[model samples]
Target: MKESIISVEGLSHKYSSSWAIQDIGFEINKTGILGLLGSNGAGKSTTMNIMCGVLNQTKGSVFINGIDLRKQPELAKKEIGFLPQQAPLYKELTVDEYLLHCGYLRQLDKRMIGKAVDEAKERCGLTHFSKRLIGNLSGGYQQRVGIAQAIIHKPLLVVLDEPTNGLDPNQIIEVRSLIKEIAEERAVIFSSHILSEVQLLCKEIRMIDQGKLVFSDTMDAFNNYVAAQSIRVEMDRPPAGEELLKIEGVTKVEFLTARSLKIYFDGDHEVTDRIIKTSVHHDWHLREIFFDKNSLDEIFAQLSNYTKSVN
Candidate 1:
């Protein structure tokens, strides 16, 4: 088994009377990106703060490479690099200058700061823009500078909060590629409201709603879970919901549009065959029929809505 680089157990936080997060726990045991997903006030920031040692959790513990965060704050933090939603940058400083300053702040030896700065710039594709002032660069380039600063000390884990929040489509693509490049040798924990971006970048996902974890699983497992329960059908003249429900394995039928239906059913391949046969028998002019697996966006909306209704 791979050793866990970071372990969070029973993590919780409260502000005065209201709780910000509750009993959050997870472990990163390998080099891969872990995505944190949630809505506007879903405690994503609180959780990241605790993990990065910005705010101590009201309860529970965090371990980075077997070192307790509370017991050895400096030692634990030495292995982490963090970039919040807003990239921290001094507009007047050049990329190289800022990275060198970061290396110094991390207490790197004076002799090693220049080499570390050069490597970080190379890794982030900032070597060409090394002498340009940060404020004069594009948003994508500035974000690269932020990431470069974060990794200047070569930390074992990097935490990023909404790294691609406000970029153009091209910039989003560029930054996403950069994130994958950085994750090649270390673990990355990032939070984003963009489901598609998370899907593209992360193998494992942790979704939170109302300060509570609602789902945590690998992307493949999540897709399989959705696929086992639903099927989508499109036809020129679709049958009634009542008629579709009468199919052998179907449990419910939802109309997406006049020509489309979403059918919920048991995980039986035969159900699909039955649906096709029924459409043919009715001369429904079937256009499409396939499993109605929920995308990560749909799943997030469903979970967040459920949390709101219950609360």
Candidate 2:
């Protein structure tokens, strides 16, 4: 089995009496991308801070590559690379100088620092811009430099918070591709409020709401959750909502248009066949039928609302 790069257990943090995060826990194993998804003030940054040793948690333990963060902070932190929402850069420094400084700061041996800088620059596509001043690079190139700095020490785990936050569409695409490329070697924990981006990049997801974990599962499982609960039927003439609800196993019907209806139902393929047969018998012109899978945004909204209602 692959070794876990990071493990968080019962992690909680507070500022004064106000809790920033409560009982947040998860593990990153193997080489793949995981997403921390939440809205503004939902404690993503707080959880990240604790994980990266920037803030001590009020309770619980964090282990990076099996070293306890609270007990062996220096050793634990050596295994992590973090890129905050705002890219940390020295505007006056050239990309090469900045990355060299990062390598030295990470305590790489003088002999290894040059090799590390060269490798990071190649991986991040910054070789051509190595001599250029960071203040003169485009937003996308600057972000690449930030990423290069994070990986200069070859950490086992990378944590990126909203890496694409300020980029334009083309820049977002470039950064997204770069993130995926980096994850090919080390585990990555990406935090973002952009639902589509998370859906696109992450194989697993952990969603936070009101400072608590609301959902944690693989992407396939989340997709199955939406698929198992809903169906969509398109007909030339849709039945009335009451008539559709009368079908056994169907709990609700939402009319999407004059010809399309979204049906919520318990697990019963028989009920779907019945709907098809009924449509055919009534000359309703059944045109299409399929499961109505919820988008990540829809799932997030539902989970957030449920969290609010429960609290």
Which candidate number would show the highest TM-score if scored against the true structure? 2
Model 2 worst lDDT run, 10 consecutive residues: 220-229
Tens digit of lDDT per residue, candidate 1, span 1-311? Answer: 55579999999999999999999999998887999988778999999989999998899999999989988999999999999988889989988888888998899999999999999999999899989999999999999999988888888999999999889999989989989988999999989987888889999989888898888899776555444478888899987899988899999999999998889997786998998898889898999988866777767777778777887
How big is the positional error of residue 212 in model 2, measured in Å on the Cα after superposition?
Answer: 1.1
Candidate 1's C-alpha runs over 4 A off are: 1-3, 227-230, 234-274, 283-288, 305-311
Q: Rate the local accuracy (lDDT) of all candidates.
A: 0.88, 0.89
Q: Which 10-residue span in candidate 1 carries the lowest summed lDDT?
A: 220-229
Q: What stretches of model 2 exceed 4 Å from their correct place?
A: 1-3, 226-230, 236-271
Tell me the number of clashing residue pairs for each predicted model.
0, 0
lDDT of 1 at 91: 89
Model 1 pairs whose backbones collide: none
Q: Which residue pairs clash within candidate 2?
A: none
- Residue 243's lDDT in candidate 2: 85
